[model samples]
Target: MPTVPASRVPRRRTPAAAVVLSVAVFLGTVLSGCAYEYSADHWDDESTSAAPPPSTDAALPQDPHLNEPVTGEELDDWVDAVLPDAAGQVFQTGFGTLEADEERKETTAQLPKGTYALTLACRSTRRVSFSIENGEDELVDLSLRCGTSRVNVVQLAADASLSIKVDANAPANFAYRVSRI
Candidate 1:
């Protein structure tokens, strides 16, 4: 019998390694054929209503900590700066820190029949979720990425008791304002 040299033997890949390699190749092929688009500054495209036209007046100051998460006083200041000025009558405005343990905060405001803009901004370790409802009917529900701002326009055919809920997976600071447009 002749003994074969170790260098002449073919290496055998483990089942786990083969599965991983197959998954990588499959994902690469599938992803390469799909086009993914993202906008860091705009709200989600599936929002129920379109955002109002940008104000042509002097633009507000840009977010100073656009690329990083912020907490404490810095988050409060960021929220204040990013909130849009009341173009018409102001219905509600609030700013506060959402503690990590608390997870969520809810508030309600009575708004008269009119068109209004709901602006929300947050600085957090993770994306924060927002749900806005007029009485029992949900108006807007979306999760905003950290360090971004969103403005949603909502119409009230009749007077409504508007409720806004904010939820964060971790500690965060947030601000929201509802004002007639």
Candidate 2:
């Protein structure tokens, strides 16, 4: 290589710090132009406002027979009235009257492997306790108030025996139905 004097060598004309400061200033100017401001007049315009749509649902009908006492055929009729859409093949249906002295009543049914809805209702009673079991395993236990009905969904993995026991606080009429859904 040919030898060159120290002052004769060429060097970069621009310093790195100057180039970085120039880039920062350019970005700040560009970003400031994108700022937005909202005014009261803009919000007053209906076209830019957000409002909820009106509801289309009507009020539910009242049941006049909810507080009445019923038994035997009338008990069954009440169940039908409450659960109007009992849609599905019914596996079991039971209706009976419980005496004030009776402690409880238990019923059993053989249900195939499937999903089933168990509906229970009672009238003329203070409260009633319902216990449902699949063989040795208790599936559902609930206390139902008089003049009301409750539906529980049970899923059976295999064909099994189901036992339902109802205990009432006062003499009342009760009805139950098990249907596959």
Candidate 3:
């Protein structure tokens, strides 16, 4: 059979095939764009220039009985009742209380060589920052929102010790307690 020359052959165009190819290309482009947009919006981009917002649930819940601002007298009474023994007293000595207009306070405690769980409760009506430092290292650094509490576990060597620093910005006299787990 004689072959038709390229210039002499008719170019047949199928409309259905063209429609199907066009639809496929359109769908591919749209889906790709949508997927890229979704990932860009939801993915955690570390390179973002803006600072990441803090977590809303970062604050811990406080005990019902000790979730209010306390006067010095009330704080003393509460401490005596809640921590009634030598062991409690030993832990309580590490806590700091902030009266109205007080600038700042720091308390230190020497933990024996062992693993211990530490719990901090803040009964304040205003925002405050509580940080626990083990020697030169920071162990627990958290901004205690109003009426928030926190708990952490710390392991200490034979000579390790910790300091509790409280910075208050509220007018209400606040009482904070640190106890061993």
> For every model in order, what is the number of clashing pairs?
0, 0, 0
Steric clash pairs (candidate 2): none
Query: By descending lDDT, how would the candidates be arranged?
Result: 1, 2, 3
lDDT of 2 by residue, 44-71 (tens): 7566465657865668564755555676
Displacement of residue 108 (Cα, Å) in model 1 is 3.1
lDDT of 1 by residue, 1-181 (tens): 9998777778999999999999999999998899866676467677756687877756677655563556677766676688857778887887777766455656656678889999988777678888988878999998998677899999999988887888777777778888899
TM-score of each: 0.58, 0.58, 0.47
**Candidate 1 RMSD to the real structure:** 13.3
Instruction: Candidate 3: list runs displaced more than 4 Å.
Output: 1-68, 77-96, 99-103, 172-181
**Selected candidate, larger lDDT, 2 vs 3:** 2
Candidate 3 or 2, higher TM-score: 2
TM-score, structure 1 vs. true: 0.58
Q: lDDT per residue, candidate 3, 1-181, as tens digits? A: 9998777778888999999999999999988877333556556676676577886774776565444566567867755544334333345444446766565656556555665555555556666676777778887887766544455677666656677666676543333444454
Look at candidate 3 and give me any clashing residue pairs: none
Q: For residue 149, what is the lDDT in candidate 1? A: 81
